[model samples]
Target: MTLEEQKEIQQLKQWLMQSQHQAVISGCNDILRRTREDMRVSQHILKEVLYLKAVAYRLLADVNSAIETLNELISYFPDYARAFQELGYCYLASDRKRAAHSFYQATRFNPALLTAWLQLEKMYKADNQSQALALCQQQIAFLTSLPRALLGATDLMHEGQLHKAEQVCRQFLASNEHHPEAMMLLAEIGIQLKVYSDAEFLLESCVTLYPDNDRAAAAYQNLLSKLGKFPDAVSVAKKRLQYAPESFTVKVGLAHALVGVGELEQAIDIYRELLSENEDRPAVWVALGHALKAKGDTREAVNAYERAIVFADDFGDAYWSLANTKTYRFSDELLAKMILLVDAEATKLDDEIHICFALGKGFEDSADPTRAFAYYERGNRRKKRTLQFDIAKTEKALQAQQQAFTKGCFNKTQGCQAADPIFIVGLPRAGSTLLEQILASHSQVDGTMELHDILGIASSLSHQATPYPLNVSALSNETLSKLGEQYLRQTRAYRQGAPFFIDKMPNNFIHIGLIKKILPNAKIIDARRNPMDCCFSGFKQLFGEGQEFSYSLNDIGRYYNAYEKLMDHWHSVLPGEILTVQHEEVLDDLEAQVKRILAFCGLTFEEACLAFHKTKRVIKTPSSEQVRQPIYKTGMGQWKPFESYLDELKDVLPARS
Candidate 1:
């Protein structure tokens, strides 16, 4: 909001506080009218104005107007907990049940709303709801137990004032350094700020100092999973499970970690056992479907996904999972139902996003490009709002890598010379997984899921004063070799017995120099695709995590350009150290490209590589189903159908030859 607008809001708040109800309502309406068409007005400002207006109306005994204003505020900002709380007050006299429901929803979005909890406690007591009253009392007790500063920090965090929240948390932690809850709160703030290493350290310390604290353990485990440290996540999950042997949530979490570590059979067994006890959980069914799909059981996966929708018709991830299979066809009835759910007011933003993408795929399959592009754009736009992607930061990082890793730097040091790791790196949706599949088909190669060890190493180095890429040049030769050995040891859990294993972390393209510095003999394959195809494919995909740039066409285009520039720098600094594999070329002649990849990897020709489609292995990534079948030409030129809607992307991308 502008300075003038902020001043106006402040004045309105003062009026409301001074009991000038009419003046407050008039001021709010005036502000709203002036800024109704102003795109510069932030959602936060608008929400504040509307909430003030509602409070003023309630104080003036204009309950209907108050309710109307609160509903309007909620329509724009669905998760506005304060608006719901105000609505509860507006309805308390006329409809006690609805008042209680509104208060319940207020606490649901934000558990720190002490007033809502107190009100719920009274209503639950009056209604003789023993279970709800007990829960309400517990929440009230917890909130009352927290220090004033911590409570303020919790409120600030919930209100999206993350920096303020961080300040308050740090202040509280300054004197009480070992306070677990304070550490957890700071860790949460760190996670929001994308400081994963710091968050990990805080949570790890919290859990270590207080191993019995379930919340601390769970947060640590979740952060580990977010950082793609699945083995560590598995350990944490197992620890939690030991603490709460019958806790379904902990068991489900453990199963998810198991899936991440490629223990598909164990994850599947756990899902089945959980489902046998309770067959109505839609999320569990979806989890089961993912494991089944990864294990190469497409039909059973489809059945599981269908069962999730059967149990909860509005479960959007289940529908998206079915579409993600790339083989399941949504029937007319199901498609209609999905349309209704996507348009429904009660459908959550998370669900709406999944449904939008799913609908895009569904329409694309039906050959309705116009409808497909519409849903794709809707999903991308919605997803983009929830992310923070700065292309300039990406460009600067890539440039730093270029400057740090000059040819002279590599000549100064010798690496570990580990030939076991063959890294397939590039932008996602660029056929790296396909390359991994073909290579893993060879008798000598093991295909691991997109391994995170290299990224973890980079993250650890990022905590140093100089940080990674820049700091890489300062490492001694012995340290480099030790780092290389560390990587192999860390990734060992994902490997079986093959002499060579593939780490198909596409984002590893950013760390080519680090890869070379550590493991000089590790083969790096740059998976290339047509710029238009790759960017569009990425734009359409809803990755589980860490591809924030893909949600916007301009961001994705700039990212691809930066990636190309960085890859060129890697090639220049370390000549012949990396190989480029074009996805289209592979499509044109699978056998020849397969042979070329094998030759580059120093592997002999193998018939199994030719028959990669028949290889039965657990596959992750969106292209799992596609790679499991014979090579097809349909995926090529897919962007052409949506060409008209890609002007923003085209403007940012270099002109194609």
Candidate 2:
């Protein structure tokens, strides 16, 4: 409200943070009394004041008083995670059994509660509950991966306060120089800031300093995998397994590494074994589903996903996995259950978002567009609140790419002559995966996952003061060729024995200039779709990672416009260097479009390309199931049913090309 009132709130928060519990309780009570008479304080501020009072009571060992205060606080704010956690602490001080339930509630509302995870882990271990203990371990992995200081910083990082989090983490590491968790946290911050070299160094040093920290080692291995160092990742996983053969975490790591190296059958075998050992592990079931789906066993994959749902009905990933199948229709009973869960306040936000999107698909399939649009909008709105995607920053970055990658810029530097890479780049849900499938079906083209080599290169390039394309201007010819070589070497593990490979990373549309400069002879395919259909499809899908722009209709439209303008620029400056594959054209005439794509890639027409639907492979994108089926025109205007809710998006889109 007033500046003085704001200052008072900040002072109260600072006192509470500093553990002046009694002082905070007294101060907050005085404010509450004055605000009650003045009627100036907001409800949210009042709630926070009460919450701090409850925390202070709990810290002072007044368990009953804390419980009463927390109950009152939660009556008004049922979704407050910290209040729930404090309730757990108070109950634990009295009765362990009740504490366990309270802790469960805390974690149920906020899965990121590290303290609750650790408490659950201890409670389960004491009760000799192996399955529950294992689940707790999974949750604790994230908490144990970071030091206390970094753990405290994660909230700030997630809130998009990156610089503040980085400063806090760095300050901790300054004194505790050898803290691996703090180093790893800094590495994570570096990644968020798009500085790959710094992140890599921090992770490597973390592993070197603390070899026994499996989480740090795993983080290092994961960083390697993200950078397309599949062979190195496999080596790291295997090394860990050699020491702790019984560690399920290491076994899972090995399985993931095997998948990265294109050992799909072996990965499936490992996942199956893990499931045999612990059938109650929902995460393992989800992993099995992914491996089976990648291996082209659609029936088994669906069964695995269903098994996960049976084990943990509230797990959002399981429901989203089933929805991502595209071909799987939710039963009427399942739809009703999902609707109930989506409406439940106790359901975790992540799980609720997944259930909402799944319900949207379910309603759409049942021909209930009104309900479907409501669910879709609800899910998108919920997710948009959690994201920190800045429209201005995205626009500026895209504009920098256009300005930096002029014809003269590319002509000044030449890349390697390696033409093995065939990139399918465009917005998500734009049929990029389908185009990749057709190309991968060719005898000479090995279909790989949406490899992150280009993004990794872009991140490495963005290590300077400026981001991405702006930093590209300072790179020399030697650096460009080296980057091209690095991409080829890093991606080697994903390839079979084929001479060419497909990298179907959709967001690579932003890095077309970098792609051209580093690998001048590489083939580039721009997968184009109807703007309404593509953006609407993305709005409905819940991606496991990345694609922050799809969470809101305005952001989605802004991204699509930026993508369209960038693609137009690429076409203008690099004429005849890129092929545009329109999704509607393929649906209209599959054979003709397939032949045209083959001709552009310098490959002869083959029946396999026309029958790409039958060429089964591991498809990781949202369009995974769609690409496994023959072309159809039904998806062309699927956005029409939801057009009434898309006026804001329509206002931002250009006229249909």
Candidate maximizing lDDT: 1
Task: Compute each candidate's TM-score over C-alphas.
Answer: 0.89, 0.83
Which residue pairs clash within candidate 1? none
Q: Candidate 2: list runs displaced more than 4 Å.
A: 1-161, 192-194, 465-467, 654-657
- Model 1 segments beyond 4 Å from truth? 1-16, 19-109, 116-138
Instruction: Mark the 10 consecutive residues where model 1 has the least summed lDDT.
Output: 409-418
Tens-place lDDT per residue, model 1, 56-83, is 9999999999999998887667667888
- Per-residue alpha-carbon lDDT of candidate 2 for residues 88-167, written as tens digits (9 for 90 to 100): 88888668987887788777766667888898999999999999999889878866766677777775665345888899
lDDT of 2 at 208: 80
Q: Please give the lDDT score at residue 472 for candidate 2.
A: 81
C-alpha lDDT score of every prediction, in listed order = 0.89, 0.84
